[model samples]
Target: MLDFRMDTFLAVCQYMNYTRAAEALNITQPAVSQHIRWLEEQYEAPLFTYANKRLSLTREGELLRSMALTVKHDEQMLRRRLHDPGPGAHRLVFGVTPTVGMSLIPEPLARYHRLYPDAPISIRVSNTESLCAALDQGELDFAIVEGYFCKSDYDSLLYRREPYLAVCGAEYQFEREPKVLSDLLGETLVVREPGSGNREIIRRALSRENRAVEDFRSVIQVSDMNVLKKLLLLGCGVGFLYQAAAQPQLGQGLLRAIPLEDFQESHDITFLWRKGSVFAQRYRQLFELLSPQDIEGESCAAGD
Candidate 1:
């Protein structure tokens, strides 16, 4: 079970405003203050500072926040594992970033269902950061993510390495024989929202070229995969994504890939779960079933 006071403190950290936190928790602002005061008394240190109408976590607050999150996660996991699966019922909760959710999970999920037809599976699809936050809250048994995360905190396995390509509508014209990062300066860019794995990969690659998102002529940040693809097909802007994501469009000649001259961005897709989780065995089985090589091979065979 999770502690109410800890939950209140976490809400405060998340929103960074006492009133907002109170509203979120459906508690009075003074009650929220009372909980913080109680925690401060126990910990013997101030957890937050109020200055210039801004709220910031004190050093002690930061440490408590981390510990409280860990305790909450551990408690959730213990409760889950202690509960019986029940006769002929196997339940699971998992998450994935958009890219992996779109490309990789379907086949394995299908196979898993075939093995345990009566089992119920819950799937959550979001960006890397949100998925990671859900994992910390113990809402997911495991996750597949496409962006950078704190590898030290989880037991992670490399799922695959995928190339990120610059693509645009097939009918769109380039200024010249565009090949490098600099050649993209004048193109409107369709990008993923902040905290996206794809966005992080693009940001790192741009940094290497001494460029940034602002260097583009224009930027359109989209969170929905379908909308982003529609924008690309409509010739709204150039986009960056995993090769797998844009492959079908490229094959249909609806889009064209522009290889970066002397510059290609690649990111690792990884399977992640909490450190020392009891679900490690179950996750390993899933990893073996959904390994990129096996999935890719099956895809190729199906295409044939």
Candidate 2:
């Protein structure tokens, strides 16, 4: 179990503000400072710094946070395993981004449930950023995410790659055979909210074309994937998202992929757990049990 000082340090990491951390911990600001100072002295490294008038974790601080979180998960998981009724019990608390949650995972998850009827699995579906934060807080055991993350912090597996598509309503006519990204800048861009995997993918794709989302005529930010799809169907704007998310509409002839010049690309959907996790082997075994076999050639693990 983590000690009292580590708890204070984690509170500071969560808020990045001493006063806020103190309030959250129900301690005086001076107490928070003393705890942090003690930690710095114990670790023999500075944990935080003020940059541009904002508090940020130092390199040492980030390392400590990662290690502390990993230890916290292991400690909690050990207790859960000790009390668990079944042998070789796996405490499954997993997270997934909405892009993966929409289409790729449900069938495989159901099959796993059928096989391991006793396993108490909980699934958290949220945006990539929220999922990553939860994982750091030891709230998740593993996550399948589709957005950018600090690779050095996690052990990852390449689940599969999915086609990324730029799409529009079938009835929405382009002024020309839009051959490149620049041609569509006049159309209002419909995007997932900031910090969402789909939006980050869109940002990366746009950057490759020497453009950004802001270059669009206007922008519509939607948090709900369903609402975002609906907006696209109404010809309100063009959308960039995973093919799986748009597959139903495309199959129904309600949406069409916008053809881009020589732009056939796919994006990685990855399985991630904290690096050096005590349950790393169990997580991989679970992955082997749940991975969809149809998608080819990406079963190997990679640091990226």
Candidate 3:
């Protein structure tokens, strides 16, 4: 349980207006002011400042707001879990990024459902940042995220390494043999939105070669991978995507994976959960069910 004062502080930080925060809290403006003053006195730092009739958080206020939000979210999770144990309900909330959702999750999810027909699985797909934030705040039981290399307080395991490939329409022609990263400069490149792990990887890969995507003749940004694939199939541009994501299309003769000389780096995909959670046990069960050998191998062998 968090102090009610922290709630007031968070509301004020959100609205940045005393009157608005008071109204939201159903309290008097003076009371809001007093709460702010009390918090400031306790912390020995002013939380906000006023300049030219505009309100803004001071550095200390920003720090406090971030901490408060995490605390509030944790409290909410605790309350919800205590009130609704979710045991025997046979439901699990799994969070994932778009890339993982497209390429990796479906097969494992199908197998899990078949093995435990009574269990209902809920999936939340977003960018990597949002998924990680949700996991940290306890809003998700577990998550499969890419590019999480540093060890944190959470329990995690490296599930797979996704190799990247440069793909283009089958009909597209290139003057070079696709042996070097510099050969891609004049081609139109399609990319995901900023803040995405895929985008960051692409940026870093380019930067390390002393090159930049901006040097390309044209750049297109789209949030939907399907649309980007369509564009690539139509010979509109070249794009970078995980090999697993492009494998089916490559086999179907819709796209070609351009080989880059000496580019062998890969991104890590990890499964994450709260530290010391009972949910961790159940999550591991789910993980084993989704393991590539257990699920994908069996499926492939059956198909053959």
**Best-performing candidate as measured by TM-score:** 2
For model 3 the local lDDT of residue 124 reads 92
Please give the lDDT score at residue 218 for candidate 1: 98
- Clash counts per candidate, in order, are 0, 0, 0
lDDT of each: 0.81, 0.85, 0.75
What's the residue-level lDDT of 231 in candidate 2?
93
lDDT per residue, candidate 3, 21-85, as tens digits? 99999999999888889999999999999999999989998777666655555554456556543
Candidate 2: tens digits of C-alpha lDDT, residues 1-304: 8879999999999899999999999999999999999999999999999989899999999999888988887776677678787784555778988877878888898898778778788899888888888887778888998888888778888877889898999899877768887888999999988888889987887898788999999999988888899999999989887888899999999999998885676888889888888888988997887787676565655564
Model with the higher TM-score, candidate 1 or 3: 1
Expressed as tens digits, the lDDT of each residue in 253-283 for candidate 1 is 9999988786677777888876656666777
Position 86, candidate 1: lDDT:
70
Q: Which structure is stronger by TM-score: 2 or 3?
A: 2
Please give each candidate's TM-score: 0.81, 0.91, 0.73
Model 3, residue 291: displacement in angstroms? 3.7
Error of 3 at 195 (Å): 1.6
**Candidate 2: residue 260 Cα off by (Å):** 0.5
Model 3 quality (TM-score): 0.73
